[model samples]
Target: MPQAAKRSNDVPGTAPNLVHPAVVNDDAVRTALAQHMSRISGSRTEITSFGRKSSGFSWITYAFAARSALGGDRKLILRVGPPSGLFAPYSVLPQVHALQALAGSGVPVPALVSSAQDGAEIGFPFFICEHIEGDVPAPWAASELDPNHKRVIARQFIEILASLHRINPDATPFASQAQGADRAELRAITGWRASLARPTARYYPLLDWGGRWLEDHCPLPPCRTVVHGDFRIGNFIEHKGRIVAILDWELTHLGDPHEDLAWAMMPTFNARSRKLYGVLERAEVIELYQRASGIAVSDRSLAFYEAYALYQAAAIQMCAVRAFEVDRFNDMRLAVMASQMPSIVRAFERALEAAA
Candidate 1:
């Protein structure tokens, strides 16, 4: 169980005196960065104005610029493990590997610069890449975009997901990373169940029951493909009404393609556009995906995964709350995450009942 939030180097909060020593202008990091950038564009440079902050749970993102010997500036983003501790067992290395494999595969992810697993240099594993510049409208503010643009972005989201699903699992580097004891179908079901088992009282009997249903009625001839464990509105970057880059690959893995589809369709993530789960109606998203990737998506399958997505999200939120309650790591944002669980659980239960 996650311990209650305590003052730790990893947790971020308003402690006036607590300057994060974990983040500093160190010589070794600067040297490594300079060398890495040298390889990219033959530029000998130094990291200038590196700033780090938590985007949410489990992520410490740094935005910085590199001044080249030629006096040009390149903006970059570095995503690293939190100083407190990671909320999930998965590593960022695989996300980088998957991104590398998908380069030119029609997926709309950020362009990768470099990734490192050697934790000694930065306290924990981290990856650096190009910083995508665009607007990510708050869920409530999604309406500010023109309705047609919203529809275009919505369709784009589904099509990009379909493109990822079409990637041959064996052709990707993360194939070994995804190797597990459970069969594909069982793996998908168990993964979500485990994610939700974090300490909390907002448990849903329907999710527990739905797990059994999924196990019993496994999809026919399972799809062994890459799954973006968390695919939602907040994860993408948009500019001029087009999705420029997909962010947050920390949860990428291999499983049924429907897993990604379901996550994208989760109601809690729908934000302001309640009319469409992820700002697009289920039918519209499905049609766009089918048209783009030439694959058939059944309504029944979408419904099953939709329920599973809610279960997965509720589990993540509960875990965040548990971290706060147990003093394992405390931040107001994480504590507030706990309060969202009841609504998430209620949504799942209603979906499960309607499906039944």
Candidate 2:
């Protein structure tokens, strides 16, 4: 349950000065951050700028500037997986391990500075990373990108996709964590089945049918590596006309590369222009990825992963609904997400039927 918001001095935004009901707020987070930074750097530290970011539902994300005796001024992000966060049993280890695994792999990600699963110091498990400067062009919003820029960005996007899929899982620390493709598919199915089984969440026939279809048709990937679970247009940071970093690894795991590819092509992530991630056409993306990775993408397998992606998406949204119903978190964002389930299921059904 969320704590009652204590009265405080007027703060600029909705979550400043610990006004937000959740455990992570301006006061608690600032104190915990200073303590952690000081311990890590062996010097006193003071927080300069601190505020909550406006996006995301799974974690309580805050961006702040800190001044330390040794490190000087630094910009960083603090992500706390509150007990009430949308995803329960929050663990920072997987994301931290992923950043460590992808360090030199051409896939751009934020630098992981520190992470702790223990909530003793802070109110929840958390990870901190360098804050990259960039503008996020949301797919839902009108794009201001010119043709040349779009083409350039699209090339980079496809190349990065290729690079991400090309990383050899055996060489990295992810080898043990990498469930062979078959087990990965089974885990996804069982996990979503359990989330939907929660009585509070409304049952949707399309989701059930879609899940069954996926079980009967799950594909064994040509190979499995690190799947960035949510790789789409809006999840990256665009700075000075190029994509600098890919953000949001909460859903990341070791699975089929096609999962990431199909996820990027999901219609929910598309806007009016609707090019692959609002950049390249689907054919262009497939061609570039195939040429760069030297792996032929099987269309049959892509269809299976595409349906799995939709099913996973619906399960995620329903998790939000379950969290809300159980009074785990009171954010209206979860409610809005729950409201989108029917449409998401409809799309999933349509895709499944077409594939059938």
Candidate 3:
């Protein structure tokens, strides 16, 4: 297991100094983990493999191995919510309980070891989960997968989504997650609009115009499910040409199933091919989802959600814009995220007009 390297002025017998360019100090993290793990282990805990890892735009992650005299050793992943994360005001409760509820729902998520929102516990709300062994291919990268493998992966993606939709929400945290469908649509629009409503918002007239059109033309949700709000190619992990786990859940919520379908078809995920997410054409993808989930999808409802998904995408890009504008984070990724606004805006307008 990797440990932090020692600093010259450190205590005589502490772990080596952490020269891995970690965003947070390794010793501090070790101490926090020891304290937290002791509660479950009933003995002092040891943390190793304390290396920094950068996988996504939203959270700081540390990969580590832990052991205790009483509790066995394990490999784990830790996700910490930064105050100025890509999505601010972070809360892990919804995701934690949602994952808990989906334990047998056929959605392959990492096993949750523990979680907490108390800032004092781990600097910010944090959770530990099994370190899944899988690789996420770059969605924009050229195909290393043969045609057969690509088709299989594509089918698995939609099938997992269908399984998620079939899970009963009445007994889960998402039970009371929305008002009526119209209200929910309004809320989605309002929430995204708020991200760019500031005086400093880098506004484009089409963005505002598009928002209004979506509000005026809000259609009822086809049906509600626990929407994987960011469901797309890059968000899942693949092992042996199969999607082993659906990784990011920060945007998990209860909403229209169409939202996920439309979101997967977003421009960023579909750029490489005419197919949605580079796997299946729009009609074919929808066909698979409807067949697997046993729900008839309306073309009109899909058009509405397609436009809504683009609106949401543009607003999310604005989050990166605001963060970059104020230097909330120094990661060049924020700049990159903000840079996509022009193309995303164009895409949004095109989708909206096509719907009209």
Provide the lDDT at 102 for model 2.
80
lDDT by candidate, in order shown: 0.68, 0.76, 0.76
RMSD of each: 5.6, 6.7, 8.1
Off by over 4 Å in 2: 1-22, 179-182, 272-274, 325-329
TM-score of each: 0.81, 0.88, 0.87
Q: Using lDDT as the measure, what is the rank order of every candidate, best first?
A: 2, 3, 1
Count residue pairs with overlapping backbones in model 3: 6
Cand. 2 TM to true fold: 0.88
Q: Estimate, for each residue in 10-66, the C-alpha lDDT of model 2 and write its tens digit.
A: 567764353444454668778988888888888998999998886466677799998
Q: Please give the TM-score that candidate 3 achieves against the real structure.
A: 0.87
- For residue 280, model 3's alpha carbon misses the true position, in angstroms, by 1.3
Tens digit per residue, CA lDDT, model 1, 160-193: 8888888887888778765565555577578667
How many clashes does the backbone of model 1 have?
10
Candidate with the larger TM-score of 1 and 3: 3
